[model samples]
Target: MSQWFQYDRRIFKYFNYLLVIQIIPLLAISSYLINEINPLLFKKQMLYYGIGAIAFLVTTFIPWRKLIWWFAPLFYTMNLLLLLAVDLVGKTILGAQRWIEIPGTGLTMQPSEFVKVSVIMMLAYLISKKPPLEQGYGLVGFIKLSLVILIPFLLIAKEPDLGTALVLLITGYGILFVIGINWKIWLVLAVAVGLSAPVLFSHLHDYQKKRITDFLGQPSYPVHQALIAIGSGGVEGKDKDEATQTQLKFLPISSIDFIFAYLGERLGFHGMVTVIILYILLILHLFYIAIRN
Candidate 1:
C-alpha cells in the first residue's frame, strides 16, 4: 500500500484537467439526449465514455515530445498511404469511400481522422525546428507549410468528406495564424481563394452540390422541425408531453445533429444560455493557459 501510494504515474501532469472538465458539459448533454432517445444508447455511450477514458490515460503515457518528431513523419507517411489505399479499396457507405474495415474486428475506421492528428503533430515538429520569423514566414517558408497542409486536405476532400477536410484545413491554418504567417501571404491567399470559389463550386460532388442547393432552396424537414422545437421553448420549457417537437418525434436526430434544438425544447432559453456560458468559460480558460504558459 505504501509503495502504491509512493508511486506516482503523474496523472495530473499528463493532460490539462480544466480542458477535460470543459468536455463534461458536452458529455452530460450527449448522454442525456441519448437517454431521451433510448435508455440503451445512453448505457452504450457510458461504456464508450469509460473506454475513452482508458484510451486517454494510455495516450498520456506516451513520451510525446521525445518520440513525436521521429513518429510524426512515419505516421504522416502511413496516413497518406492509407488514404491512397482507401481510394482504391475502401468500403463505401452512402456514396463516399472513406472507411476501411479493421482486419477481423468487423470494425471500420476513417483514415481522414488519422490524417488530421498526424498533420498537427507533423506541423508542430516542422515549425519547432524552424520557428517563424519576426514578420512571419517568408514566401519559401509559406509554401513548405502549405504543402504539408494542402496534401492531406486535397486527399481527404477527394474522399469527398469535405466537411472533415475543411475542418482539418481550418485547424492547420488556425495554428499557422497563431504561429504567425506573413500578412502579405495571407492577403494573397485570401484573394486567390475568393477568385477560385466559383471554380471550386463547379468541381463539388453531386451530393455536396445538392446539400448546398437544399440549403439555398428550402429548409430541410429536420431544420424546420428543429426551429419549431427551439421556438416553442420560449422563456421556460414545457412538460415532457407538451414538448411536441421532441415528444412527437418531429425533430429528427434530436439526440445528435439537432441536440441544441432538443435542449432548448426541454430546458428553455435559460438552459441554453447556461450551456453557452460554460463553453465560453472553457474557451477563456484555454486562452488563459495559452497566454500564461
Candidate 2:
C-alpha cells in the first residue's frame, strides 16, 4: 500500500496538473451542451468518461519512452495495416469509409486516429536516437524522416479523410519544426509547398474544394448561423428560453463544433473570455513543461 502510494505521489508530482485542471471546464461545458440536447446523452457521456478515465490511467502508468523506442515501428506498421484493411473489409458511414468494425463485436474504431499517435511515437524514437545535426538533418536523414511522416499521411489521405490527413501532416511537421530543422530546408520546403499549392488544390475532392471555396468565399450554413448566435450574444447572454439560435436548433451540431458560439449565446462575452483564458493558460503550461522536461 505504501509503495503504491509513493508511486501515485510521484506521478502526481510530475503530471501536468494545469492541463488536467482544464478538464473541469471542458466536462462542464460538454455536459451543459449535451444536457440541453438530450439528457440521456449526458448520461452516456458520463459513462464514456468513466471508460476514458481508465484508459488514461493505464496509459499514464506505462513506461512509454522505452516502449515507444522499442515498439514504435511495430505498432506503426500494425496501424498502417489496419488502415489498409479499412479499404478491404471496413464499414462505411456518412459517405466516407474511415471506420473498421471489430469482428464479433458492436464496437468500431477509426484507425486514422491511432495513426496520429503512432506517427509521433515513431518520430520521437527516430529523432531522439539520431539527434539533428547543427546544420539540421541532411538529405539522407530528411528522406528517412519524410518517409516516416508521408507514409501515414498518404495512407490517411487515401482514406479520403483529408482533414485528418492534413492534421497528421501538419502536426508531424510541426513536431519537426519545434524540435529544430535546418532553416534552409524549411525555406525550400515552404517555397515548394507554395508553388505546389494550386496543383494540390486542384487534386482535392469536390467536397473538399467546396469547403475551401466556401471558407474563402462566404461563411457556409453553420458558420453563418453560428455567427448570428455570436452576434446575438452581445455582452451578457440570454436565458435558455431566450437563446433562440441554440434552443430552437438554428445552430445544429453546436455542441460539437460551435460550442463556443453556443457558449457565447448562453453566457455571453464573459464566458467566451474565460474559456479562451483557460486554453491560453493550458498552452503556456504545456510550453513550460516542454522546456522544463
Candidate 3:
C-alpha cells in the first residue's frame, strides 16, 4: 500500500496541477460571466464545482486499477440500476431522461457519466490481461472484449446519449486496437458502420434527426440560434455588455457543453487558444503516465 502511494505521488501531484491549471481559469472565467448575468447562479456553480473537485481528487488518489478490478461488476451493475431508476423515476430535463433526483440529498445524478469511466476501466483491465497478438488466443480475447464493450454501448445508446455513447464506442475500439486487434476486423467494422448509418438515422428521435439534418443546413431554429451565437462572437467578439447579454439571453447551454462558446465570446481568440494549449498539455501528461505505467 505504501509502495503504491509512493509510486502514485508523482501522478497525484501532476493530476492536481493539471486540474488547477485547466479548471481554475475556466471556472474563473465562467464565474465572472455568471456573476455578471446572475450572481445567485454564479455562487451555485462555484459550490457545485467545489464539490465535484473534491470527488475528483478522491477518485484520483485511489488506485484506479484496484478500484476497477475490485468493483467493476458492482460499479457496472449499480450504474445500470441507476439508469433504470432514472427511466422509472428520473426528472425530465431538456427532453432527456438522463438525470435522477435523490430524495433528501437534493442532488441529481447522471448515471451515464459513471458508466463511461466504468467502461473505460473495464476495457483497460481486459486489455491488460490479454496475451500478445501473436498468441492464438487473440481472436477469442477480442470477441470477449467486444462483448464487454458492446453491452454498455447498446444500453447507453438506448438512453440516446449519442455523443457519449459514440465516445465510448470510439474509446473501446481504440483500446482494442492498442491491444492489437487485427486491422482486418477494424475494416469490417468500418464497413458495417458505414452501411448502418442510414438505418441509424432512421432510428433516431425526431429532434435527434433534426439536429443532424440541421448540421447539414436543413431549416431549424436551434441551428439558426447556434449560428447566431457563433456569428455574434465574431473574430474578436462583442464588448462586455454585449457579451453578458449574449450569454444571459442568446447562448443556450452556456454553463455545460457550450461553455467553450461562452469562453470564446468573452475571452476572444487569445483566451480560446490558451485553453486549447492547456488541454493539450494536460492530455499529453496523462498519456505519458499511461505509457509509463
**Global Cα RMSD, each model:** 4.1, 3.3, 3.8
- The sequence of per-residue lDDT tens digits that candidate 2 reaches over residues 157-202 is 8878999998999999988887778788888999999999999999
lDDT (Cα, tens digit) per residue for candidate 1, span 197-289: 999999998878977987999877788898889889987877667889988889977776788898889888987898899889988998898
Best of the two (2, 3) by TM-score: 2
* Number of the predicted model whose lDDT against the real structure is largest: 1
Off by over 4 Å in 1: 1-15, 38-44, 88-95, 103-107, 210-218, 238-249
TM-score of each predicted structure versus truth: 0.82, 0.86, 0.79
Task: Mark the regions of model 2 whose C-alpha exceeds 4 Å error after superposition.
Answer: 1-9, 38-44, 102-107
lDDT of 3 by residue, 1-293 (tens): 66444346666556546546666665676687677656776776767888987886666556766566667767767777777777688787887777888788666777888888777777766666655556332556778888877877777777667777788888887777876766667778789989999998898888788777777877566445555665567677666677753546666666565666666676677767877887787778778867887
Model 3 vs truth, CA RMSD: 3.8
The global C-alpha lDDT for each of the candidates, from Candidate 1 onward, is 0.85, 0.84, 0.71
Clashing pairs in 3: none
Q: Distance from true position, residue 143, model 2, in Å?
A: 1.2
